[model samples]
Target: MKWTRDSYRWIALAAGFTIILVGYAMRNTFSVFYPVIVSDFGWTRGSTALMYSLTLLVYGLFAPVAGGLADRFQPRYVLAMGGVVVGSGIALCSTPTSVWHFYIIYGIIVAVGTSLIGITPVISVVSHWFGSNRGGLVFGVLGAGFGVSLVTAPMYQWLIATYGWRSAYLMIGLCAIAIIAPVSLLFIRRSPHHIELLRQKDTDTGGSGTTPGLSGRTEEWTVRRAFRTRSFKLFLLIGFCNMGFAQQVTIAHQVYFLQDVGYAPMVAASMFGVFGVAFASGNLSSPLSDRYGRVPFVIAGCLSTAGSVLLLRITPNPDSAIIPLLFAFASGWGLGVVPPACFAAMVDRFHGRNYGSIHGTMILFISLGGAVGPWLGGQLHDISGSYFSVFTLVQAFLIVAAVLIVFATRPASMRITS
Candidate 1:
């Protein structure tokens, strides 16, 4: 039997989504092992965080190169190589005897591995598989994989409990190989056709605003050229501030923060879970931007997230279960909304030919932020003896991110040649 274009697109979409979900699950779940690794190594929180920071830096730096490889070659091969590197690198961490080893192995090696099949490449490839008219919804589904992984704290905790952290590393390593490698080898594909031209949706009636491209010409851009635009620079700033400060600070320290404030580890994970659920909801809802417009949703999300950070700061009891959950819900919703919207906005302007490379370059900036944020947060905690200064920084970053979202609307004059 033969499959219709519509039928197989959905099937491929599901496979791609699952692959993304699993890939991120392996990467994001590392935080659950944070305390254990520190205790085992007798490393300072700052130093331990340094490893994570270094990893993010390496991942960010390599992301664009990976994107270019995917564009130039076949993405499946990249994904396949990523599975081996990720799995093996993670497994090797089980034996590392020093923090420097971790910095080199988990930090550098794992980061490089994760970069290849990461959001930048996957979305770049998947975009080709779907129609531009449905781009918002398709990418939203893809982004949900990363958002939902935020909820996997319990699973990570259980793995650590059932098997020690070393063994847990081995488990995830094996899973990465078994799951990601096979899926990539069997199910993933390169979309051989050109992307359907973007449909400009009218805000008033949720209908197509105009035909594709500028003045009836399909505009394309290069990664280096996109960096010359005002909007792209603003986009870079938002990515940098958000990833470098807000997200890394939260992910690296929030669990420990909850514990410092009298919450148990499980309770801490629960807060992350709440954030994850709200985040996943946001990802799912972002597709509505197809009708509603991407910028408004991103702006709303940035404001909501900023408000949550402030609320967390002011909360009389970080120990109060209900309050943290409420804050998490709001924070998660905001972050979840921003990613898809931001990604779509980039595609709207700088898409075609070098989109993967361009997206990768953006990821590079975001990675720089991720690399710096965790280490900075850790140092601040050591100096101030509280998360006050760290969250203060997070609030400031969110403000910048919010402002950038407003200006990152597609640049009317931006265009480039391959």
Candidate 2:
């Protein structure tokens, strides 16, 4: 069967989804490995988590550069190199005998590799293929890849249990290299124009279909001009508070918290999978925000996520299965809902030639939060001897995030006419 213009968009979307799934899975597998590594090396939780923090830090720092590279060059080549680098990083992780070795391999190397193939660049590519009409749904589905990657948590646990962490890392790394490099090189294109899928000039709508400006005149936005606006600044805070702090803190430490509260390791891993399932559901649901408006979903997602932390704090029950299930689903859905809606909103406003760079910078802020969150969660746990303070801080951040979303999405604030 030959690929047509109509079919190629879906192909590109699938390729993007696969890249995100495999790349993010490599990063997330660290959660499953956390306890095992600690057990093997006798490192303090705070010290052990610092490696994860370093990855986020590096990922955040490099995101804009990755975005800029994707914007200026053939994204396939960039993504293909990312596949090789990330795979090598993961594979090399198996050989680390010391903390510094692991830090260099997983923290800096893997971080840079994944940043190349991550949401910033992938979304930049997809934005060119898709327009505003279906942008919400498209981004939602694309973002779902991240959530679905989490479903592999249980599998990672099994791999570690059966073959050991080293072999598991090696196999996963090999698979990433074999799969992502080929798929990205073959199927992913920088834009629809590369494939000869040309729409009418009026329908071009840039990458994301429509500009947020009511003028209907498409204008290009440089990073500096975008920075001068309040929306971009608000989004930076949103990314930091929501993606960086809340997400990183939760992802890095949720398994440990569950295990600490009397749940077995396997059980905690399973619960992590539950969160992934719910996260995909919430992620996929963001399309509704296109119709109803982005603010509601963003606010609701923030509140729901905040409430889940509160739920876990008040009702710590390892004996009953319900609490874990409820916490996982609620938190996952709430967390999942925010990003696509937020991304869609960003694209609605800022999609242009330089969107990749703008989006990458946003991820950098998120990475900064991510860099701090896991380490902070670990240190807080070490200091308090419980997650009580950590949960409180998460709730506070979520509330602030909710407030930021309202102001960020306000109609009066977004008057960026060309």
lDDT of 2 at 81: 95
Write down the TM-score for model 1: 0.90
Candidate 1 backbone collisions, by pair: 244-369
Per-model root-mean-square deviation over C-alphas: 6.3, 4.3
Predicted structure with the largest lDDT when compared to the true one: 2
Q: Each model's TM-score, in the order given? A: 0.90, 0.92
**Which candidate ranks first by TM-score, i.e. highest?**
2
What is the alpha-carbon lDDT for the whole of candidate 2? 0.87
Estimate every model's Cα lDDT from 0 to 1. 0.78, 0.87
At residue 67, candidate 1 shows an lDDT of 89
Q: Cα miss at 282, model 1 (Å)? A: 1.2
Against the correct fold, how does model 2 do in TM-score?
Answer: 0.92
Off by over 4 Å in 2: 193-218, 415-418
Q: Write the per-residue lDDT of candidate 2 for residues 1-418, one digit (tens) a residue.
A: 8776677788889899899989899899899999999889998899999999999999989999999888767899999999999999999989988899989999999999999999998988887777766667877888899999999999999999999999999998998899989999898885556333223324445656654443465446668777877888898999999978998888999899889889988999999999998888888999998898888988898999999887787656778878888889999999999999988888888877778889898999999988998999989888888888888888898899999988887766565634
